[model samples]
Target: MGRTTIGKSNAKIILIGEHSVVFGQPAIALPLPSVTTTVVMSQTTHGQTLSSRYFDGPIVQMGQNLAGVAALIQALLTRFDAQDTFFHIAITSDLPAERGMGSSAAVAVAITRAMYAYFQRPLTRDLLLATVDIAEKITHGNPSGLDAATASSDVPIWFVPHQETLQIPFTLQGYLVIADSGIKGQTGRAVAAVARRKTAFAQETNAQISRLGQLSTAARQALATPDLPQLGHILNDAQQQLAGLGVSSTELNHLTQVALTAGAFGAKLTGGGMGGCLIALCPDRVTTEHVKNSLLAAGATDTWTEAFNLEEEHQ
Candidate 1:
């Protein structure tokens, strides 16, 4: 590489569809501008190495959890026809690992961008996502590609398996309050569990999955109409389905309940669940604060807010 290169990617949240998306259901993935992951690349005399909180050594020696990153680096080098390339990759991220905030996917996205930039190769959005998915497959056994897509996009997205993603116009008249439950989320385990649940209770499981898909469809229409309350209701309904599917954890459920009790229009766990973050829909900035405080009081490690708008809507 000629000089140091930097690549950045923001976090993302699955607005509704989760496990169901893997089964060909539509999903909404929203970008979380509050946090981000940045990867820095520079020349190194030694062989390829990675520096991050989780590991610091040769890329090949990284733990199983980081296999995706290692694989991405290998794949990138091979693509560049520089197998003997030596460089250092350093990752710094505000996106907490295992919080359903797309940490792994963001990292992979950042890495791919940096690699492409350092190689002086043009990168397209399609190429970027495809490259990142290479790593995602290693990290998440059967990822639906929502994380990579949303993490790289600036706007919200409507996602479906084996289909091109479409950006959804953003317009809502409320706020979103997100809180971390302070425990590592086992996305792999949660996804596998859902698969087992589907096998053990095919009919019921399929029904819930279909319900989540329906809710997603409704959510899209609600967003188009800019119906905040209706959107919140959809989120609440989706949460119930997720709970029935056995993915929600006690901490997540309690936090979501605390938000609802605090007057959130609706609330639910936002990702693979089992232990992660919960998102609450608040009617205004005032309610957003209340929900944020309530989640913290209910044991949330941190909180964030996203506002659709406060300006009066003709509706």
Candidate 2:
């Protein structure tokens, strides 16, 4: 009986520690402004219809892998079918699908939030995150549950795969420059590959992840204290761990080197990493711009800059 609309949540880039996180290492992720998804609801005469517009592909096709999302809507409709709560859902996002940037999670968060608003109910972050996790199963199969957590709450979070999940509201200093390689990474395949490899190299991988996790704790403390140099050092170590996991691509490696050579504070391949994007931690705008220029010079297809803050936004 009431219309509802939910504001979008931004996607994220792992500043450091990728595969290491899978083994229980700590990773630093910062939300990006360029990628976001919003859900809008309005009164209609028919049943619920989901419409999404993405950066690429057809708009209607955006719902291709959103089975859990569809299921959630169906369940709601069944519960209120008598009222026939006619709803029209429209999704618009800057996040690209399958890029390991938490696009699907953003959509799921927005959808759940909108649904809550429709019923004049309070929306809790936990409820929004849980709904997104269900949808993640369709897209990521066995996702690490990090992306949804990040999208649901915009901040630097510490997730220990299967061990622990916590959020640290540490305000980050300086800017983050990200460059897309125009190569899409299959997160499902990458996660599956890592799981398969775990059986053979469990001891070694677990040890590395544990080390990364310990280092991550120190890094978290450093982040809280706002020490940029120490944070950069941890990022360098985390990148090495990710490389050892065999996720870093040659192109991504080249990009990382280029950023480092250009005087970037820290640089590493982010996301699923067989291909995707690289995030460079820069100490200042000057360095960030320098790294960005170097990335473009080295054939990076797209580049974006964002300033991350741990403080919540004013509604």
Model 1 scores what on Cα lDDT?
A: 0.88
List candidate 1 segments past 4 Å from native: 44-47, 192-204, 308-315
lDDT of each: 0.88, 0.72
TM-scores of all candidate predictions against the true structure: 0.89, 0.85
Candidate 2: C-alpha lDDT: 0.72
Candidate 2 residues 172-218, lDDT tens each?
67777778877887555666767776778998767666776776787
- Index of the highest-TM-score prediction: 1
Give the alpha carbon lDDT tens digit for every residue of 1-315 in model 1. 347999999889889998899799999988876578999999887688899999998888999889899899999999999889889999999888878899999999999999899999999999998899999998878777888989998778999889858888877767778789998777778989999999999999999999999999999998888888899899999999999999999888888889999999889998888998888988877788888888898899988776654554311
The 10-residue segment of model 2 with minimum total lDDT is 53-62
Q: Name every residue pair that clashes in candidate 2.
A: none
Number of the top-ranking candidate, with lDDT as the measure? 1
TM accuracy, model 2: 0.85
